[model samples]
Target: MKNVLIVDDERSFLSSVSEGLSAYAAEFNTLTAENGKKAIEILNSTQVDLVVTDLKMPEMDGFELLAYMSRQFPDIPVIVMTAYGTPEIKERVQSMRVSQYLEKPLDFKELVDKIFLELAASSEGYIRGITLPTFLQLVEMERKTCTLKITSKGRIGYLYFNEGQLIGAETETDKGEKAAYEIVCWEDAEIEIESICRRKHRNISTTLGHIIMEGFRLKDEKERAVEKENIIEVGIEETGEVDGEEEIILETLEKEEKMNTLKDILNEFTKLQSVTAVCLVGRDGFLLDSIARTGIDTEMVGAIASSGFGAAESMGRQLGKGELTMSMLEFENGPVMFSPVGENAFLVIVAEKDANLGMIRLKLKKHSHELAAVAAI
Candidate 1:
């Protein structure tokens, strides 16, 4: 069963909508809030799948509620209702990414249909097949307020968020930023979202971006240590002898070869005209590797590129077009390109707006297979 939160200031209208939706009681339960403040209280305690809100209210209006939801409950879809609907108002509502907007005197059947559609499209209360870094970037981007219970390798940890900022984190034996770093670096972590944040006081002062970068560094170090240990153990087991010096040399050569292969491929894009950044990103939005001349957030770039490319591919399918070969988004400063590298990852190129796009496309096509080969490795 699903819960639908309806927020409206007018008592009579609210009652009418609730009564009308009661017919679908078996399908979903309706929760009513007179204003946004009350609505938030319900959200903190209940698992709401959809929100239907009126734009005007005394304490907190629909827009305020929508802003709050965008930060805290972005996965939940919303339907905006307003009596004073205009073109301008519709445009503003669209920008907020509302699932549907119905002017005053809405059709009851239409409203119910929209609700059902939105609910059906939701994530079934589980966020899966997404990387932790990508999910964290989403929380930061949306300014969400929630607590995430993360389980990885049979160990559990908690990350608290208040309005999109990572306020606190903890494991059974650790707390604060140190715990956060460890949790972020965990492999194959599963996340469960809680709408309420229990931590009122901030415990971590480090920025999320810096924390993520540091976490990746720590993860790399830990992986290297494990690899070295495994190599030593294998030698001792197979030959009944351990040569620390030889193992160290072999590890160094292996690491160098792997790094050089990907590095050489990424470096080629840096030599191109007006290129600012080049990256290989996993389909799940993880940044595999990157080369950048500018101070761009490569992680953020990779996350956005993966999401945008997915949307483009979806759009193509809907339009009866073929597979997405390449897609680009042109902004005032530059253009960002996305193309599939292999089944598991893609390539991203960020360049100045006036850069020779034709040449860049040619280079991208020429090198895509090579990058795919490296990714396969």
Candidate 2:
């Protein structure tokens, strides 16, 4: 028999759903929680096959609960219930990849059908008790040649390996290295291994270690972006009162002033000879802002720059250096420089090979204080 947990704040709705589902007691058991907190307690103590939850509750809302489940019990399927049912809400839930979504005033028979379907699907072809990263590492250690089929949240991807080296990966929308990055970052995936290697040529040139690290960085960046959007939405909702209008206007103006100051500092850097791009990046590897002469993925550059700078800082510490003020990486085409801007962020400068390094360094030192002042705001 399976156990299905239903979480909502309404006692009357819980009572009705539990009683209505009692007819199928022989097939499965129904569990109820008043809010996400209670649902978490029940989940910690009991074996739950599925979760059906509403989006809003007093303590520990549905979004928080879903995040907890994704980290702890990713293999278990979920069915989301929401009264708002707005496109924005649906899109957010879809991004989380829930098994099913049903609006409030749910049809009893339909809910039951979805529960059974999810339960049955969860039971099939799931390679439980192992993590994707661990399995990949083991395959590499064993020097195995094969292909892996991975499924998570209704998406499927394939990874091809030859003698333990990842050669290629494929998904519906991505291929090669990009696809591999996406697949490696997936959580709670069901994996199937086949003893065959179909792709003879290598499409992914980077080591598996690099791919995994980049995958995690990409995942963290995406999560942070989503969190920032949520915070902005909450801020807007909270400031909707007429009494807060003047305060809101003042705050907006202050923000604009700080932004203009930062942009001015960036513009100074852009005016330097042979300078291709200038970016302000958070210490956590997120791009705060940028100015560039050409099209470039500044976010990716920010993340990589942070990682590289971190390594350089570690090296300096080991070498008994007092502190790391600046670091630079030079390639055949250009040089990239990284320097601390403020306590919370850093500055990056990309310049052509023929650029005057002495003048660039001098300008960087001159404007670093100004940039730091604006960044601190």
Candidate 3:
């Protein structure tokens, strides 16, 4: 049901591994490549669920391939195999977040078990190293009838899809459309799939694409509400002292308590009537923290902002400009501003077109130092 790509330069080893893993034909449709270059070609053309690759190859070895995957096909998990795996090599490979690493002369049975574990660990299926949308899209493409159990940030929920149609969903307290939207919007959620769909009635009639889009819309609203609460909590607790760390017992409160205080500054900016959204995006295109009104897609905005900023920064360097200080874009509707928050994060502000840019820039300049402290922590 899943496509797995195997890459090895040695013709004999490649043939043997492919032939041996043929037993899993019921679970995976296997594909093979002689080197990383070919493997990338196959990846570009095929929908691969996983990649099992040998480290040393004639051209574009596994390390290079792995690096390429990290940038382009990050959703696909990889299993790295190599005979010359030393501690140094293992450490470097692990940094890339490969699913598994195996030294040469692999145990065939153990390898099979590992593959199955990576695919789906138990009688109940499992999914990791992939986004929820991608996984749901796969389910729809395959016309799967299954119950997807999800756990995220201590909340648990279930989504029931019968023959690729989402029929029902539930959380501990909510059910139907609301629950479905919430479940689908979860990021980095751990998922388990059961092949049976128990719900007989359909609560959702919208197409899957529409549902996903709406789910994201709802997610952004929920995040803003949470941010509002955090803001209120910290605003009232803000002391006249510029330094709050003196009151925080480092040994007792832990780093998390100290680190969260950084966002407290952003909460103050939202008090401005013109500012509609505030987001902190990491360099890797992840939405770290945000506060925005309904109808805003913070996730999409963050990803786009990260990509756009990265490109702009690269362009500046190519033009022989010094490091970029700030990037701003204005439309007829409103103006958006971006500035480096810290080493690895960027601060984004979405404001009304009529908003005072000078005032906002001044506030950002004054508070940017505070933000940097939070980012450092």
Candidate 4:
């Protein structure tokens, strides 16, 4: 069980919060305070693993508490729950490196997850540590604009950062987050913090773009394919016999051949002035194979893109809009390609500035139909 501290001015709110957390009764040992002064007194002596504090307290507010923690117990995770937030206060909290932030009328699910993440955070060596809600909320608060890209499984995606929040996203051939979501239908790794985006393009219609990528052209996440150290076994019989079924043999052979051929394509693309690498994923953004020059971690790329695909779909549904279709990504070194294979899959490609966009489009225009037909089979 972990020890926790709750500091708030409102009696009812404090009790309600305590009760909610106590529901997990056995997992956490909770302590409460009516004001920041009492909370500080408790912390000065007792050992508390986490703190759930309200922003505005009568005496000694959340900021004061944050300062206290920073000075004495920086390692202890602190989560700020507030109804109102100002730019100045938000900036101050960011600098403090608060573990997480919660906006009032607390989201129980989000809150629980935040706690879990804080608990799971490694105390020792860590390269990339992500405080989800805080980071995401900061982006929204600041309204910063940028692009965040990620890849996993065998797929890839592009997330558009607007005002420091996830405002939009897409794939190599799609226009918006919605289209990217549908094509890369991965079960996990779908959140924005771990998604994809390159150029942050806004002129294209995301839905149509995803459809075009999957239904019209067969593409893949070539530039970001994870280099597998060991050879993967594609297919085998029940008894580990490869001679049982002709169709199985053909299918296994096809997957391997495609991956190898795709590698060749990526190698050549990297050599071109405006070309990077190319990927051949399914209409659903399921990576079939890929090619790339730079050592891009394709597994992470595929997982992230798949989640982006899902988010795009969820956002579209919330808006009472249609499904996403295709998208694209532009990067400093090269551009990422997205082309659909069929109803359930799509493809992605990475290229440099000099890669012929017109030629790529023409090629996709011709191949997408065939790819979609195959996907249906």
Candidate 2 — number of clashing residue pairs?
0
- For candidate 1, give the lDDT of residue 281: 93
Q: Please give, for residues 239-357, the per-residue lDDT of candidate 2 as tens digits.
A: 77545574675577557656876896798678654689999988888888999876878988899998988888889999999678999899999999999887878899999875546
Best by lDDT: 2
- Give the per-residue lDDT digits (tens) of candidate 1, residues 228-291: 6786566567665456656665676566656675786688677654679999999889898999
Candidate 2: regions farther than 4 A off: 1-128, 241-377
> For model 4, what is the error of residue 17's alpha carbon versus the real structure, in angstroms, after optimal superposition?
1.7
Candidate 2's displacement at residue 167, Å, is 0.8
Q: Give the poorly placed runs of model 1, Cα more than 4 Å off.
A: 1-128, 235-377
Candidate with the larger lDDT of 2 and 4: 2
User: What is the number of backbone collisions in each predicted candidate, taken in the order shown?
Assistant: 1, 0, 0, 75
Question: What RMSD does each model have against the real structure?
Answer: 14.1, 21.7, 18.2, 18.1
Once model 4 is optimally superposed onto the true structure by TM-score, how far is the C-alpha of residue 287 displaced, in angstroms? 14
> Over all chains combined, what TM-score does candidate 4 have?
0.36
- Tens digits of per-residue lDDT for model 3 on 240-316? 33246534533323345445555555775675536788888888878878888788898988999998899889999
Q: Name every residue pair that clashes in candidate 1.
A: 71-144
Candidate 4, 1-377: lDDT as tens digits: 67778788888977887888888778777789988789989998898877878756677666446545544565677777865457664443433224566777788888777776666552432212223223334334445454544344555665566544454656666655454444333322223332233454464343322433453233334322322211223344333664657466657665665555445544543433244545555534466555555787654455556666556666777998876655567778656666555566665656665354544554556556545544454
- Candidate 3's C-alpha runs over 4 A off are 84-97, 121-377
Report the number of the highest-TM-score candidate. Answer: 1
